[model samples]
Every structure is written in structure tokens, then in C-alpha cells.
Target chain A: MTRLLGWILRYGIAALFVVAAVFPLAWMAVAGFKAKTEVVATPFQFFPEVWRWDNYTQLLADESFLRSLGVTFAGAVLFAALSLTVNALGAYAFARLDFAFKRILWVVVITTMFIPGIAIMLTSFVVVTQLGMLDTLAVLVIPGAASGMQVFFLRQYYLGVPVALEEAAQLDGAGPWRIFTRIFVPLSKGAFVVVGATSFLAFWNAYVWPVLTITDPELFQVQQYLATFRSDRASEMGLLMAGSTLAALPVIVLFLIFQRQIIAGVRITGLK
Target chain B: MAVTTLRAPARDTRSRGRPAGRGRRRETKAALIMLAPLLILLGIFVIWPLLHAVYISFYTWSFYEAPVFVGLENYLTVLTDQEFVDSVVRGLAFTAMVVPAQVAVAFLFANLVKSVSRKTAAVLKVTIYIPAVISEVIAAIVFSLIYAYRGGILNWFLGLLGREDTAWLGETSTALPAVAVPAIWIGMGVASLIMLAGLLDIPEAYYECASLDGAGPWTKMFKITLPLMKNIILFLLVTGFAASLQFLVLPLIMTQGGPVDSTTLPNLFIFRHFTNDLYIGYSIAAALLLFAVLGAVSALIFRLVRSEKAVDG
Candidate 1:
């Protein structure tokens, strides 16, 4: 009886934690299909009386919403690509190269890793403004492209790549660039994919940075755009819920498709 | 070893007519090419901004106003401002709540998952990690609904248990903790994953030996698990603390530092001063102070970790 009780307690707690993690998101998705009035109705409408597609369909048709989504989508893609290239190249050099000031340069990168992004928020915006990159896609994608953590992770990965392969390629007269592209890039696809996928999710979900920087309605990120309607918490509440759902759907889908990499990405990017 | 041997001897024989300096120069050039883009971007975006933030913290600049160099006046203002002081204290309290809770939750979730069957653990891990992946705005939105007075999930569940409705975000006292709940929810998973990695990394043999010695689960954990995973636990605490220091999104979205500014944590204060109020110098000074505190704490932890390692090294 005691052992059975223990088993029950263990799994029960586990189940509770999982439910707590997922319950809010699941409700948001469900409430997206409910009428705005029905969302906050008496007896707590757990399910919609009539499923509504108007919220999503209307957002798809709305020019402002579409523009925001387009910026976010394109920004995420460009960020992932740019971040992957910059960090991967730096990592490759750090791992494999014999170069001048390598130690000093690497120390700089690692030290900057400890300086939290929030700490530098004001100055970064000032720098971007001075550079005339404000309200443009360049501000979103370019400034965040280079990452110390990514470079570090990829460098660690490259260190594990066999020197023998590179030596053989060297023997075959392949240049350093060719060897990197043909050999290291192909071999480190897992690491690169992990970085790229996380970068995409990060840019997609980014709320604070865009909120601070972007004022142009045309260039508003998806999350910032949705935040505007949140104060409109009138009868359009369900529609707002639907907007939140749509904003989060891609990441959820991405997580499901590449969960293994994404989970590894969490460890890769979350903590040192 | 084999590759180095073959390549090393073959290289000298193959390039006997050429000096090693030529190859060294080529490798250096290649490395420079590879590193240029990253270095340039980091210089502009990361390094220079940090320097400039410190530089601007000394000036008096606001929205539509020219920046005037005011020496150390901004720093003085940040130090004396009562609102800023209250926010920092609230932020510390929030950190105090979040850091320990995150470490505990991560420990609890990690150990539970570690004890389960592999398949079940995998499934549970994925679902439980959902909050970490979702955006802060969406999470905050869902949570706001959950805390809604009329039709909130929390109040509904409480009402089922015959409890009274509480204005969680609307009440001055409850607003901070209410805001902190989602912070823990969002941050705890990755900390758990780190802890899980640390847990899995322990040699199964150590636990087996402890079990053979009639060790209880708690005993085994304290004796075998905790001691081995000290570094990882320390890491999670410091990292989680740093993360919670930047607690802005939820408070910004959910409360707007409402109920008489009770939910205004440090980051929210800095953000408001920077963007909303556009007190650039004061905000930058406050941010730099925050940066200094973070740096000092991190440095202190490294010192602690290093000293601990000396005894155990």
C-alpha cells in the first residue's frame, strides 16, 4: 500500500507540473475559437458554443497584421541565417585556426558573454539610432546576429571534428575556405541547425527588444503588434486570444518538428 | 595521433623546400577572413554599445533634448531617487523569490523525471518545457487570463475548492507575487534541463553502491547526488538570478507596474525611464549601475567557485 501510494504521488506531481506548463497555452488556443463575449461569460465557457474562424481569417486579411507577420517571418529567417554564418565562422576559426591575437580576441568574446543584454539595452538602441538603422529590418537582424554563446558552442563542436579530415583535405590542395564549406559545414549540420532553429524561435518570440526599438507600425514585430490590442480588452478579447495563438503557433510547430534539436538548443543557449 | 603523425612527417617532406612561415601566414590569413564578420558585428553591436552605455550614463539627455555632459549628476540622481530605490528593492525581492524557487523546481522536476521510465520522462520533459519556448507576451497574456477575476482559471479552480476570488494583479500586495509566478514558470524548465543533465551525468555505479549500503533516496541524493552536482547547481542559481534580473516583459504587459507601482521591478524602471519617459541619462546610469551589480555578483561567484575548487581540486 505504501509503495503504491508513493507511485501515485510521484506520477501525480509529474502530471500536475506538465499540466500547469501546458494548460495556459492550450486554453489560449481553445479560447481563440470562442466569441469575444463568450470568453468571459458566466459559468466560465470552457468550450466555444460556435467555433469561430473569423479571428484568424480576419488577421490573415488585415494589411497591418499581415505586414507585421511578414516582417517577423522574414526577420526570423534572416536572423537565423546570419547568426548561423557569423557564429559558425568565428567558432570554426577559434577551434581550428592558428592566428594572430586569437587568444586576446577569444577572451573578448567570452567576456562579452557575461555582460547581459538587458544591461546594455539603452546604449545599443542609441548606437543603432546613430547608425540610422532604426525602424528598419537591419536593426532587428544585424545587431543580434553575432552571439558569443553560439560561437562558443560551435567552437566546442568544431574541436570535436577530426583534424584528420581537414589534413586530408589540405593534402588534396583544398583551400581553407573550401575545407570549411565542404567539410566542417556539412559535418556540423546538427550544431548549426540547433543554433539556427533557436535563433528563429528567439526572433519570433522577441517582445522586449522590438517594443523598445520599433515604433513604425509597418516594422512592428508580431509580439509587439499583438500587445497593442491587449489594451483593447473589450468584446474583441477572443480575437486577441486568436492573435496570440497565431503569433505563438509557428514556434509551437517548430518545437514539435525539431524538438530534439530545440531541446538541445535550450541547453546550448540557456546556460553556459 | 595517427593523423598528426602522418600529416606532420609528410608535411615536412612534402614542403621541405618551403619554410613553415609560409603555411603559418596562409592559415593566419584564412582565420582572419573567417573571423572578420563576427568581430565587426560584435564590435558594433555588443562591445561598442557597452562602452557607449557607460559613456552616456554621465550625460543629461531626454526625448527631443540635446545631450549635455553633466559629469556625475545622473549617477547621483539614480542613487537618491526613491522610486528607483523601491524598484530595486522589489527587484531584489523578486530575484530572491525566483532564484530559490527556480533552483527548487528545477531540482524537483529533474529528480522526478530522472526517476521515471525513459519514455515517460521524455514525454513529460517536452510538455513541461513548453512554457520556456513560448514568447513572454503570449505567456503573460495566457497568465493574465488565468488570473482574471471573473473567468480566470485560478479563481475558477479556487472556487471549486470553496475559496474566495482575489484580485491578483489588481491588488497592490498580490501583484508582485502574481507577476513572479509566470517568471518562475517560464525560467524553471531550462534550469531543470541543466539540473537533469547534471543528474544524468552522475555515474550509475555511485547510486548503486549507495543503495547497497542501505541508503534512503534522500540520503543518496544528499550524499551522492548533491555533492557531485554542486557546480551545476551553483551555475543554475547564478544564471537564473541573472535572467530574473531582467524581469520586464510580464510586469510591463500584465500590470504596467500598477496598483501604485508595486510591480515595478528594476528592469521595468530602467525600461520606462529609457523609452517611456525618455530620461536617457538617468536610465543609462541606472542600467550601468545594474550592470555593475551583475558583474560584481558574477565575479564574486567565480571567486567562490574557484576557492571551492581549490579545496576539492
Candidate 2:
């Protein structure tokens, strides 16, 4: 009975996850094949009587959806690159450099972790607007390019890298740049991968700043567009679901590929 | 190891500026050089914006009017406003309701995951974490479909049992909790992952002894697990509180913070004021207040967690 109970509990939790995780996607998928009447009909059917391929066709025909996808993709990729570069160097400094006020500076940076991003977003908007970057992808990625959590996590991982490797490169009379490029960069690939994964996921999924900064529908990232689309009930539910499914596709792929690194990074960052 | 140490081999080396210190200076310079771009980025992105935000919070301004310094008046108005008060009350209530539910469910799920084989654990982990990866807006859309008034998948499933269709999102009573359903759904996976990490940190020796002493799984869990996982629990409590306090997107998308502002959170209120120009000063004031509350809560959590860690140690 005890063994049976344990088995039941294990399957129970697994079922919970499976249901919770896949149901939304499943609903989206099922609903994509559903018509408007079938979508709102009483005694909801999981499967539609008629598979409407027109939903996909209609969504594909929408220029706004395509543009939003392009904008989101570009912003996410650029932000990921910019954040990764900044985090890599900053983390290297904290881990290896003998700088004045190192501990104080580190504390300052890490404390920013506790300050919620939304609090600073208003100021970010003002600055971005002043700089004439509003309604552009630069505004989307530039203000949030550096994150304290990313820097701190990278620093932790960088500490695990052998310090002697850098010393050896220096012995060859390598310039600081050369030493960093040759010795540290290659060795810290794991940290880079982890940081890059988190950065990408964050940038891709960002909604608030994108909504605030970009007033032009042409500049709307996938999340913002999908949100606005969902808000309008007149828009076909199937097409909206299809777009949402498409928006999630890249991150889902990224997660599958780098699940270990991403999970480890999340766990480490969340510890603080 | 000795060979690798040549790059900057000084463990106890004090200053690298003098005759022997040249190498230290070089390494330090390199470190600064590497870190320069990041500092510039952080200064532009994080620090400057934060200072600007605080500055703007003190002023009465919208996009239309030039910002006028209102000092503490904006704050006073925000604090005394009935709507603001109601929003804060509702936000706290939601946090109070949701945090315990998410944490408990997550712990249960994590323990279940640990019992399975590595392969099954991986599959479960992927499934659970999928929601965590999806954007909040997308998750809201997904749930909106599930909680649709008449034709939602959930209501359809319920219809098999001869239950009447329920308007999950349309009703004031069900709206906030209904929105929270997705928030908790996505949150459960992240929470479970955190708890699993804590579970792994537990030493095997404690579990072995409990089993040898004839403790069943329940006894072992209570006696050995929860005590060992206290720090982990506290960590979740603090961060979860901080994150949930900013709950805006789910409610914004699902109910627009309504069925009569029943679901309007503090952050959504801030969003509303900031966007509309009418409440710019008031919004800033609300945001600052939210920030102050969050700061106080986090500090309290920090002190509590530290004390607990010390006691456990």
C-alpha cells in the first residue's frame, strides 16, 4: 500500500506538470483548428468539427503579425548579444581584477538585483525618448542591456575558471586584450552559454518595456502584438493562438537545446 | 597548476604598481579594460535610469506638461487616494493567497520529481519549465482561452460531468483568482525547480539514517526534509513576494484589472497612470510607494532568512 501510494504521488505530480505545461499549448493547437462559433459554443469541444486551415492562412496574411515577429526576433537577438558581452567583461573584472573598491562596486551592482525593473522603467522611457530612440528596437534592448543578476551569476561561474590560465598567457607577453581573448574567453564558454541562454530568454519574453516604448504598430514585438491581438475579441481566436504558438516556438527550441545550462543558471541566480 | 599561475601568480602580493607590481598593474588594467563596456552599459541602462525614475517621481508632469517639482504632494495624494488604497489592499491579499499556494504545490511537485528516474525527471522538468519560458502575455492568452466564458477547454471538459458552463473571466468573483490561476501555473514550475535544487543540497546521510531507523516516507519528510529545507523555503518566500508584488501583465491581459477593479493590482494602477497622462504625477507617486513597500518587505525577509540560517547552522 505504501509503495502504491508513492507511485500514485509521483504520477500525480507528473500529471500536474504535464497538464499545466502542455494544456495551454494544446488548447492553442486545438483552437487553431476551431472556428469562431465552435470556440465560443456551450459544451466546449476540445476538437473542432471542422479543421479550419483558414486560420493559419489568415494569420499568415496579416502583415502586422509578420512585422511583429521580425521586430521581436531582431530585438531579442541584439539584446542577447549586447547583454552577453557586457556580462562577460564585467564578470571577468569582478572575478580576476584587482580593482580599487571592488567589493563596494560588486555590492552596488548586486543590490540593483533587488530593485524591481518596473520601478526604473519610467526613467528608462524618459531617457530613451530624450535620446530619440523611442519606437525603435534600440529602445527595446539598449536600456536593459546590462543586468545585475547576469553579471553576478557570470562572476560566480568565472571564479570556478582556473586563474593560472590567464597568468600563462600573460607570460607570453600577451596584451590585456589578447590575454582576455585568448585565455579567458575560450575557457569561460560554459558561463557564456548559460548567461546567453538566460539573456535570450529574458529579451525574447519581455513585454512591459516593449509595450511602453513602442507606440507604432510597425515596431511592436511579438509579445506586444499578440497581447493587443488577444485583447480584441473580433480577431479570430484560432489565428491569435497560432501567432502565440509561433511566438513561443523559438524560446521553446532554445530551451530544449540548452535546458541544462539554462536550468543551472536560473537555479544559481535565484539563490540570491 | 604552477604553469598556469604565471599569468598573475601572487596570492599574497600586495601592490603591483612598484618594481614587482608592474604585472599586477597590467592585470588590473586588463580587468578594467574588460569591464569598461559593462560599466558604461550599466551606467546608461541601470544606474542613470534609476536616478531619473526617482527624480521624476518627485515631479508633477505628464507628456503634455513640462515636469514641475511637486515634492511630496504627489506622494501624499497617492497614499490618500481611495483607488490606490484599494489596489494595494487587493495586491497584498493576492500575494497572501497565491504565495503559500505556489510554494506548497511546488514543494509537493519537486518531491515527486525526485522520486522518479533521471530520464523521467528530465521529461517532467522540461514540461514544468515550459510555462516559465513562455512570456507572461502568452501565458495569459493561453489561460484566457481555457477560462473563456462558454467554449473554453476547461468548461468543455467539465460539461462531460453535466456541469453548466461558467464565465470564469467575466465574473468579478472569479476573475482575479482566475487570472492568478495561470500566474500560479507558470510559477509552480519555477518554484518546483528551486525546491528541487534545495532538495539536492540535502545530504544523503540524513535520509539513510531516517530510513534505517524505520521512519516511513512521511516521517522522514517531516523530520529530515522540511527542517533541512527551511532556508530554501525562505528564499522562495522572499523572491516570490517581490515578483508577485509586480503582478500586472496577467491581470492586464486577462481582466484589465476589472469586473470593477477587483483584480487591479498596484503595478497595474501604476501602468494605468503612467500611460494616460492624466495621472502621471500620481502614477509616479504610486510607483515610489510600491518601491518603498517592496524595499521594506525585502529587508524584513533578509533579516528573517539570515536569522533562520544562523539558527539552523
Candidate 3:
């Protein structure tokens, strides 16, 4: 009896966890396919009554939603590409090159990782405004182009590269840049993908900075655009749910593709 | 060793061709070129703003007129304000609630998943981790539906159980806890993944030895597992606490720090001062104070971990 009880207890908890983790999202997806009246019906509908496809169509037809989607896609691609290049170069230098103040510079960068972004919000905004970057895509792409954590992770990956490869390149009269491009870059594709995907997801889902910086609706990112649905049209559950689902679709797709790399990256950094 | 032999001749030729000082200068120049973009961005976006935040904390400004210097007044105002004090208390309360709940649940789930079959474990891991991939804004919106008083799923379940439905997000008493639920849920997946990695790192021999010594699962876990996973737990704790202190998006979207300022975190408080009241200096001052508190707490946790390591060593 005790053995049976323990088995039940163990799997029971696991079942509860799985349900809790996934049910809300599934329910939200269902609600996105729900009609307006069916969503707020007296007895909450577990699934949509008719599976209305018009919710998505209507959301897609909205200019603000389309604009936000375009802005988010463009900004994420630019931010990810720029940050990957910058972080990779910096990581390579830290990992393989000998330079003055290298250790001190790295420590300084790492220390800023702990300072919460809210603490610097006012000054960052002021600087952006002063530079006339506010309400522009540059506001989203430039400031976050050099993440300390990304550089640190990529440096860790680069350190694991065989030094003998670079040595061989040197024998062929290759310079540091050549060895970096020819050897390290190709070998560290996994690290680059991990960092790039993670950075893109962060930029795409960014809420606080974009909300504070961008006042014009045309320039709003997806999360900020979704927030307007909440504040302005709280009664429109179907529209809101559809918008939320659409906003989340890109990252969800990316996560499915890059889940292993993302998890391994987190583990390596966490363990360190 | 063969590569080292090859590198010796290359090193010799390079040194013979170029003076050591010139080589060093070239290496430094290349490194500087590579590092310039990162350094410049960090200087302008991170380091400068940090210093500028401290400077602006002492001045009164609203982003329109020139910032008038009012040394220490904004700090005094922030320090003395009852609402600011309440926000800090709420923030601490949220962190205190979330960090332990998240870490404990994560540890539990990690262990449970580890006991399962390999394929089942993989599926469970992905299912649990899916939430972490979703944005905080969407997570908040999903839970707002769950907590909705009229047609909420939670209330719907309550109705099935013949219980009265409560306004989870609308009540002052329940609002903070309601907000914390999603925070804990969203953070669980990453923390558990870290814990799972730590668990897998432990040698199987230790558990086998424990079982040979007539140890039960509980005994083995407490004696073998938890002690070995101390560093991972500390990592989760410090990062989770720092994140909870800056909790804004969920509460802002779900409750707007509402009902009676119950869910008003420090970040939300700072945001309100800057945007609604236009007290930029005061807002910056409050944020700086929060930063100091988080830094001190993190230092304390690190010190504790270090001392534990010393004891172990």
C-alpha cells in the first residue's frame, strides 16, 4: 500500500506540473480562436465554440498591429546581427588576443551586468532623446548592441577553441583577424546561433524600454502595441488574445528550433 | 605537442621578422579595434548613464526646462515619501515570496523529472520550459485571464468545486500574491533546468553508495544531493531575487499597481514618478536606492556562499 501510494504521489505531482505549465497557453490559444461573446460567456468556455478564424484576420488587418510586427521584425534582425558581430569580435579579443587592460576592462563590463536596467532608465532615455534617437528604430537597436553577458558567454566558447589551429594559421602567414575569421568563426557557429537567437528573442519581446522611449504608435514594438490593447480595449478579449498569440508566435517558433542550444547555453553560464 | 613544435618555428620567424615591441603594438591595436564598438556602446549606454543617474538624482527636472540643481532634496523626498517606502516594502515582500517558492518548486520538479524515463523526462523538461520562452507581458495577460473575476478560469474551476469566486487581481490583499504567481511560474523552468544540470553533474556512485548504506530516497537526497547543489541554488537565488526586485511588466499590465498600491514594486514606483508625476530626479533617486539595496543583498549572498565554501574546503 505504501509503495503504491508513493508511486501515485510522484506521478501525480508530475502531472499537476505539466498541466500547470502548459494549460494556460493552450487555453489562451483556444481563446484566440474564440468569438468575443463566447469568451465572456457566463460559464467560461474551455475551448472556443466555433473556432473563429476571423480574430486573426481582423488583427492582421489592423494597421497598428502590422506596423508593430514590421517594426519588431526589422529591429530584432538588425539588433541581433549587430550585437552578434560586436560581441563576437569583443569575445575573440578577450579570449585569444593579448591586450592592455584586458582583465580590468572585462571586470568592469561584467559588473554592469548586475545593475538593473531600471536604475539607468532615466539617464538612458535622456541620452537617447538628446541624441535624437528616441522614437526611432535606432533606439531599439543601438543601445543594446553590446551585451556584456553575450560577450562573456561567447568568450567562454572561444576559449575552448584549439590554440593550435591559430598557430597553424600563423605559420601560413595569417594574421589575428584572418585566424579569427577562418578558424574561430566557423568553429563557434553554435555559440553564435545561441547568442544571436537569445538576443533576437530579447529584442522582440522587449517591453519596458520601448514603451518608455517610443511615444509614436507607428514606432511601437509588439509588446508595447499589445499593451495598448489591454489599456484601450480591455473588453475585447478575442482581439487581445489574438494579438498576444501573434506577438508571441515568432519567439515560440525560434524557441522550438533552438531549444537545445538555448538550454545548454543557460546551463554552461549558470554553472560557471 | 606536435602543434607546439610547429608553433616554435613560426614564433621564431615572426619574432625575427618583427621587433617584439612592434608585434605587441600591433596586437594591442587589433584588440583595441575589436573592442572599440563594445566599449563605446557600454560607455555611452551603461557607464555614463550610471554616473549621470547619480548626478541627476540630486537635481529637480521634468525633461522640459533645464534641470535645476537641488542637492540632496530629491533623495530626501524619495527617502521620506510614504509611498516610496511602501513600494520598497512590497518589493521586498515580493522577492521574499518569489525566490524561495521558485527555487523550491524548481528543485522539486527537477528531482521528479529526473526519476522518470528518459523520453518522458525530455518531454516534461520542454513542457515546463515553454513558459520561460514567452514574454513577461504575454504571461501577465494570460494570468489576467486566469484571474479574471467574471469569466476567469480559476473562478470557473472554483465554481465546479462549489466555492465563491474571488477577484484575485482586484483585491488589495490578494493582488500582490496574484502577481507573484505568474512570476514564480515563469521563472520555474530556467531554475529547474539549472538544477537538473547540477543534479546530473553529481556522480552516480554517490547515490549507489547511499543505497548500499541502507539510505532511503529522502536520506540520499538530503545528504548527497542538496549539499552538492549548493552553488546552483545560490545562483538561482541571487538571480531570482534581483529579477523579482525589478518586477514591473506583469504587475503593470495585470493590476497597474492597483486596488490600493498593493502591487506597486520599486520599478513601478520609479516609472510612475517619471511618467505620471514628471519627477525625474525623484524617480532616478528611488531607482538608485533600489540598485544599492540589490547590490548589497547580492554581495551578502556571495559572501555567504564563499564562507560556506571555506568551511567545506
Best by TM-score, which number? Answer: 3
True-structure RMSD for candidate 1: 4.8
Candidate 1 C-alpha lDDT tens digits along B40-152: 99999999989888877888776578889999998999999999999989988999889899899888988899877889899977887778888889878888888888877
- What ordering of candidates by TM-score runs from best to worst? 3, 1, 2
| Cα lDDT listed for each candidate | 0.82, 0.76, 0.83
Question: What tens-digit string does per-residue lDDT give for candidate 3 at B192-308?
Answer: 887887889799999999899999988988899989988788878887988888888999999999988999898898888777866588888889987888876775665565466
- Residue A161's lDDT within candidate 3 is 64
Runs off by more than 4 Å, candidate 1:
A268-272, B1-19, B62-68, B276-279, B299-313
C-alpha RMSD over true interface residues, each candidate:
7.4, 6.7, 7.6
Displacement of residue A206 (Cα, Å) in model 2 is 2.0
TM-score (chain A only) of candidate 2: 0.91
Which residue pairs clash in candidate 3?
none
Worst 10 residues of 2 chain A by lDDT: A263-272
Best model per DockQ: 2
Cα distance off (Å), candidate 3, residue B255: 0.9
Poorest 10 consecutive residues of model 1 chain B by lDDT?
B1-10
Lowest-lDDT window of 10 residues in candidate 1 chain A?
A263-272
TM-scores across all candidates?
0.92, 0.91, 0.93
Task: Return whichever of 1 and 3 wins on TM-score.
Answer: 3
- What DockQ values do the models have? 0.48, 0.50, 0.49
Model 3, residue A224: displacement in angstroms? Answer: 1.3
